[model samples]
Each structure stands twice: as structure tokens, then as C-alpha cells.
Target: WRRKNENNNDDPDPIPCIALALALLYYFRLPTNEDNVQRNDRSTPSREEFGDVLSKYIPGFVEIIQNELEQFVNTDHFVIPHG
Candidate 1:
């Protein structure tokens, strides 16, 4: 994707990119607080709620991330052999 856009030198539409990036980040359990002072605001959606909202735009996103995580954990990079 980067290489395809590199020569054109045109900035891509930021709104969708940012939205998708946020969705992906949220999927990975990362906090994306818009307001630090009101970070604990009750109106804010819970993690599951946030995921639900993202799911509307990104189908099967949660499952994909979870599967990737499982794969990582099962990989040798994440596993340690005790002597």
C-alpha cells in the first residue's frame, strides 16, 4: 500500500484512514481517549461496546485480531522453554 502511494505524493483521505486505524487499535485493546480530563466519563462506551461499534464498520474484525493474537502466543517467539 505504501509503495503504491509513494510516487503520487498525494495525501490520502485522512478521515477513513484515521477511523480504521482507531478501530484496529481499539480492537487490540488499546485505549484511545479523546479527552484526558474526561477519560472516565460515564458516557464513554465500554470496551465491548466500542468493539460492537467497530464491528458495524469492520466485519469480523474482533475475530481476526483474536486469531492473530492466538497465533502469536502459540509461536516460538512468544513461547519460552524452561531448562
Candidate 2:
């Protein structure tokens, strides 16, 4: 999910987010821009087309992130010191 900061600006600029996402797709060796080729025989997938591809992996990604957060919270590093 793309998030906006308090001021309504993209917290992490969209370009890098898109680049990293594409890189992950490539790194995982999944069907990258080929998804578009299958759908429309295009070299580049439209945002919606690429999004459809990424959506499939979102659940697993979110679970990994959630688990990381859970583990982090359970560790002593999460403690806040008070006077």
C-alpha cells in the first residue's frame, strides 16, 4: 500500500518504490514484465497490469513484515525507559 505522510506527500517517493518492487520481482525471478506480454503483448506493463502481478505477493510480504514487527516488539529492544 502506498502511504502518504501527515502532510499528504508520498512518504517514500513513488519512483523508488516502483523500482524496488520491479527489482524484487526480477530478483525472485518471477514473471516480470512478461505478465504484460501475456496480457497485451506489450514490452511494458501498464501500472494496473503490473499491480495485478504484485498483488499476488502482497499477502506473503505483509505476513513477513508483520512477523518481523511482532518479533521486534517482543524483544527487549522494544522497551521504553521511564524515570
lDDT of 2 by residue, 1-83 (tens): 45334465746445434445564565344444656667775555454544455557653443443444465566476665665
Residues forming the 10-long window of minimal summed lDDT in candidate 1: 1-10
Error of 1 at 14 (Å): 16
Best by lDDT: 1
- How do the residues 1-83 of candidate 1 rate in per-residue lDDT, one tens digit apiece? 12123445575534334444665676446444544225766565565667678778766656645654565566475666666
TM-score per model over all chains: 0.44, 0.26
Clashes of each: 0, 0
